[model samples]
Target chain A: MPVIEVRDLVRKFGDRTVLNGVTFSVEKGETMIIMGGSGCGKSTLLRHIIGSMKPTSGSIKLFGEEITTMPAPQLEQLRLRFGMNFQFGALLQSLTVGENVALPLVENSRVDPAIIDLIVKMKLELVGLTGFENLKPAEISGGMRKRVGLARAVALDPELLFSDEPTSGLDPIMTAVIDRLTHDLTRKLDMTAVVVTHDMVSAFRIGSKMIVLGAGKRAGTIIAQGSPDEIRNHPDPEVRQFINGEPDGPVPLKLSPEDYIDRLLGHPRQKGVAY
Target chain B: MTLRAELRTFFFLNREILRWIFLGPFQGRPVRTAAVFRQMVRIGVQAFPMTALTSLSIGLTLAMQGAQELSRMGASAYVPNLVAVTILRELGPLLVGVVVIGRSGSAVTAELGTMKVGEEIEALEVMAINPVRFLVVPRFLAMLVMLPVLTVFGDYIGLAGGWTICHFAMDMGTATYIQRLMEAGHPLDLYSGMVKSFVFAWLIILISCQSGLGVSGGAEGVGQATTSSVVTSILAMLVANAVLTAVFFVF
Candidate 1:
């Protein structure tokens, strides 16, 4: 059985649907990457998998337990087995980097203070932030913050890990560093990772299986899903365009809030309008 | 959002905050007593000077004006009674509440609202930490413990301001003022103000927290939430004050 299975997942925010009938599964020890453009529901799908969001109508089974309708305590218990790294570091502003990494251990477990301190040091060391643990997140660079987030996420040694745009807003070198960390941690820990990113290079580098989410009319569905090499050579134009980073493709530029609303409400084309 | 939805969110958060306050320690590992105390020092100790200064000025103004009117009507002897009762029962709680709402309540909203917008709240959720229990409970408990104490302290300082005016400015003599205050000062009057301050503190924190958690967008949203926190809290405080006064004193 897959470690994470989501079937017929539908999430609606008012009149608009974000994740529509999305179906996917991540087997144990496999790095499944969910790659999509902005507003393509990649993060939404991640939220559902972590049980932070309830689907409008669907079934999500985490470790063979149907989590869609699970009680609050049970869902919280399931979340313990899962770790998530957000887009930004999202570390507590008031805390030092060491405190931020140790938060999960301090809050959820009964570990001794000395052991927790040891674990915090080890995790920060793994992320190349050993001596800088006392520094606030604001005191560090963005790349360091992302590394700290990764350290915090893995503090519990979770069975499954998730990341949302881990290398976003970083230069090429930092991006490579984060991608290497993700791959190394997954392999060393024998952990299943589901990552969401629009960075094609990072996705291909770390992903064992890649699912490319479509945009515009085909927004929520998986346009293509395969190995990184297979996705690199996928026949679909949307997949080709996204992977190749083309500006002009089947994806139309939504310029304004009014345009988005028009698309959402399905406005009819203007009569006799010039293209 | 509509009024119904906003109110629903407000009350729902209130229920959740109260649950975390009373029941969370029993259910979870243990309450973070240190965090609560830290919040008390921030919310309580930091506001002492501002509360003292503002309430003092208000008392002096009230006494000066009351003395003028009483002297005109040859009822100047009633000035001490007027300042004692009014400041103890009314302005003490209201002024302190408004000041705290302006100071601490807005800060709470902005702080938590920024956390919400930054995905810090989402990060907490992923870690199986209840944001309300971790964030709001400490501030809520602090406000509960401190607002009443400030109100009572404010009553004393305000009475001092009245005394300063009567003794120095009016030459009414400290003995006469003390005698009037002794005759007029009832524990029930102070109790009513304490009760009102407590209720006002709860309202301020509840509204501010709800605003914080409900924030979205970005910096603009944080500013809007902070403003709304102050406005909604003051309005609720006024309405609550009227209701409590009628319930405790009028009936």
Candidate 2:
């Protein structure tokens, strides 16, 4: 059975429709990467999957149990089976890295204090945050902070993992390091992972199966979904433009000289934002 | 935000906090004792000095002012009665409420707002922990317990200040001052102030925490929420005190 399945998910923020009829599924041990430009609802979709958000319409099933309708306590139980790493490393500022990583084990289970300490130490070492455990999150660099967040997320040895924009602001080397860490953790644990990102390198390197959210008229809908090589050599110009980060293509750029002049002259939106 | 929106959010948050407080014990050995104890120290014990200083100074001012007016009318002996009644019924609790709102209320709001913006609140949620149960309940209980204790301490210090002025500045005998003070105010007056302190503490706590939990954007949002929490809490406490006074005394 699929570990995560979202069907016909539609979310509207008042007048704006953010995710329109989105559908996807993740099998056990599969790393599915959801990638798109900004505002394509990649993060929004990930939040819905994690039960942090409720879709305006549709059903989400985790482990074949419907999450969209589960009560709070029950949903919390379901969340325990999964671990999530957020963008910008959402570590508690007041806690030491060891405390932050140990939070899950401490709060959820009745394990011995010694066992909890051992688990925390082991998780931190996995993320290369060994002796740095005593330091607070503010004392750490951005990359180390993200790694600590990863350690905390995986502290419980969860079977399913979700990461939102894991390597967003890091330099190329740090990005590669994070990507490798993610890949190693997935392979080592046989965990199912869903990652949302705009970083093509990180996405392509880590994704076993991939989906690209289309721009313009096809916004919030999948334009392509396949293996990494299939996505790397896809035919769609919009998909190609996004994957290659090209300035000019099916994906729209800023206004042209004539359009800029026209907009300055008070004529608004002469063309759609994306073609 | 509109006043109506703010009011709605405040009511909802307070209801949720109260729900967790009353309904939480059945959830199997709920253990937040350490958290509540820490909050009690932060909210009540550490506030003693400021509460004492404010109450004492206000008592002195009231004495000097009342003696100045009553001496002209040859009713200077009534000064103790005036000081006792006023401090017990109004200034002690009100001053303590204002001090706590400024000091601990703003701090709580800022701390929680930063937590919310930094995604610590969301992190708690993702960890299968109820943020309200973990964060709000301990502070709520602490405020309810501590405010009255602080008010009682402040009331005594205020009475002491009044006695100091009466004995040294106004040349009144200590025995006469104590007798008049005892005779002037009923125990109900002190009890009424305790009730007022209780209400004010909850208002400050609920407003500040609601502000913190609602914070968005970034550090700028935290600043805005903290400012709003303090301003709104002080105003609400004053309005509430007037109502409670009318209910307890005037009616």
Candidate 3:
């Protein structure tokens, strides 16, 4: 059975619809990447799957159970099975990196502190955050913060993981490093991973399956969904244009004049080059 | 539609609120001194000048008004009694409470609101920690303990300011002002002021933290929560003070 199933998910803010009739599924042990432009509802969709936001109308099943409508306690119980690496890392500023990584084990599990310490160190080592556990989030570099967040996300050995823009604000080299780490963790643990990212490179590097959001706005629909090769060769003009970084495409319709001109004049746009 | 369902929902929310109160502030078992010290600096020390200044001005203004009115009635000697009673019983605690509601209250809301918007709160949830129990409780405890202490300080400064004005500015004898102050009212009036300070403390922390954690948007959301926190806490304090006054005096 699919590990996650989303159907007819519709979300709106005031009169502006963000997601409309979006649907997809991810199998166990697979990495599914949701790709879109800014405001295309990729993050919104991820929030929906995580039960952080209520869909206007839709259904979401995690492990064949309808988790969308689950109560807080039940949803919390369900959350234990999965972990999330936030875009900004979101490690508690007050805690040391070691404490931040050990948070999951400390709060949710009965594991001994010694074991948790060992595991936290091991996870940090895996993400190249070794020996820096004593530092707080503010004391670390941005790239290191993301790694610590990743370590914390996998702290409980979660069977599933969700990362929102994991490579955001990092150098390309760091982005590649994070991408490799994510791929290695998923393969080694055999865990299903869902990543919402706009970075085409990172997405292609890690995504086994991909969902492309936004065609003409007005509640972005899934314009395309398939494997990396299939997505690169997607028949939809919107998908192709988005991947190729074209100037005149489905995206320019919503762009500000400055953004349009910046792109047209080849003034480096801060392309959503993030995980 | 069922009573059972409604009750169940109510209890769940109530538990969440309680958990936030008890567990939120100490999440990660934050070192008490560090957190309390931060709050003390923020809520207690930083608030002192404003509290002192506002209370002093209020004292001076009250004495001036009291002297003017009592002088008209040829009872100018009652100025000290009036100032002592009003300052000790009401304005001292109440003015400090309002100032805190603006200062510490808005700050708590903005800080927590930013954390909520940034997903720091959710990250805590995923770690199996209750954000409320760990983060909110300590702050609640700190505010509850500190407000009364600050109120007492404000009351003393207010009385001193009032005394200085009456003795030097109003051409009143120090002995007369001192005597009137001593015979003004019962000790219970001052005790009630301290008690009200505690309630006002809870009101500040509760409203600010709740509004902060309730934030949904990004930075803009934190701003909105801060504004709402000051407005709500001040209003709540006013209503609470009136009720407390009535209960203390009428009953």
Candidate 4:
């Protein structure tokens, strides 16, 4: 069975449909990368799959068990099998790095304190943050905080990992390092990963399967999906524009001048006029 | 958010907190006592000096004013009775509640608002850790226990302030002052104030935490939520105090 499956997931905020009939699945040990421009519902989709959000319609299954309507206790039990690394690191500011990494283990298990400490050290070392465990999250650089977040996400050796823009703010070298760590974690530990990122470099480096979500008219629907090479050679011009970092593309950067003027003047759109 | 929506969210959050505190232990998820102790220090012990100063000031002012007014009627000896009845029955708990709302309640709102904005709450959720259990219950438990304790201390300090004025300004003997205070206060007076403090604690924590957890946007949102939390808590406490006072004394 696939490790994770989402079918016909639709999430709407009032009349604005953020995600429209989205569907995807990830098999065990496969790394699926979801790439999209800002406000394209990448994070929202990830939240639904992880059970943090309830879809307006459709189904999601984790480990062959339906999770979309699962009870809170059951969903929490399912959550123990996976880990999510948020975009901003989201480390509890009051906690030391070691305590932050050790949180899940200590809360969920009856492990000895010494053993938990040892495990925390090992996790920190995995992210190249050894001996820095005593410092609070605010003491670390943004890149270092993200690394600590990654370490904490994997602290439980979870079977599935969901990362949201893991390398967005990092320098090139740090980005490469994070990408390498993610690659190593998946390859060596046989873990399944679903990563949401727009960093083309990191996406190409670690993504075995890739999906590009559309913006503007396309909105939340996937515009392209396949292996990394398939996405690289996609016939879709929008996909090409996104992957190549082109400034000009089918992607709408701003509203038309007429629409902007109408919005500024608090006037409804004229009848029979295209947005 | 609409008032109806906000009210719904507040009640739902309260139910979740109650469930986590009462039922979580049976499900092998107990409230961490260590965190509760830590919050107690932050919420109660650290607010000690401020609580002390405020209670003393209120007590001293009450005595001085009561003496000045009663002396006009040649009933200056009734100053002890006035101070004792008022402090034990109302001002002690009310003053401490306001102090805590200012000191610790706003702090909880700002802390949780920042966490919500930064997605730390979501992170906790994804880790299978209920944020209500991990965060709110500790503050709830700490405030529930400490508010009453602080009120008791404040009541005594207020009585002491009244005693100081009685002894020096009124030229009344300390024994006479204590006797009048004892005669004026009933056991029900202290109990009524304790009941008010308990209710105020619940109001402060629930309002502050709900505002914090409901925060959106960013830094400015945190600031707005904290301000709202403080204002709502004080209003709720005042309303609750009036209701409880009527229940105990009038009805």
Candidate number of the best TM-score: 4
After superposing the true interface residues, what Cα RMSD does each candidate give?
Answer: 0.8, 0.8, 1.7, 0.6
Cα deviation at A200, candidate 1, in Å, is 2.7
Per-model DockQ: 0.69, 0.75, 0.46, 0.82
Clashing pairs in 2: none
Please write out the lDDT profile of model 1 over residues B80-189, one tens digit for every residue: 88988898888999999999999899989999999999889999988999898899999999999999999988999999999998999888889989999989888888
Cα lDDT tens digits, model 2, B1-251, are 78899889888888878777777777652748889999999988998899999999988888989999999999989999999999999998999999999899998999999999988898889889788988888999999999999999999899889888899998999999999998998999899999999999989999999999999989999999999999999999999998998898565
Which residue runs of candidate 2 sit more than 4 Å off their true CA positions? A171-174, A268-275, B1-11, B29-31
- Per-model TM-score on C-alpha atoms: 0.92, 0.93, 0.80, 0.94
**What's the CA error at residue A203 for candidate 2, in Å?**
2.1
Interface RMSD of 3: 1.7
lDDT of 3 by residue, B1-251 (tens): 25566446435544765666556457544334556667777888889999999988887888888888888999988888888889888998899998888888888888888788768998787655667656776677778877898898998788778787898778988887777888995688789999899988877788788778778778888888799779878888989999999999885
Where model 3 places Cα greater than 4 Å from the true spot, the runs are: A93-99, A110-121, A130-144, A217-219, A248-275, B1-15, B19-41, B56-80, B126-128, B163-182, B216-221
User: In DockQ, how does model 2 score against the reference complex?
Assistant: 0.75
Model 4 Cα RMSD, 1 decimal: 3.2
The C-alpha lDDT values of all candidates are 0.89, 0.88, 0.83, 0.92
List, residue by residue over A23-106, the lDDT tens digit for candidate 2.
Answer: 888899889999888988898898899898899999999999999989998999988999989887889887899989998888
On TM-score, the stronger of 2 and 3 is 2
**lDDT over C-alpha atoms for residue B79 of model 4:** 94
lDDT of 4 at B105: 99
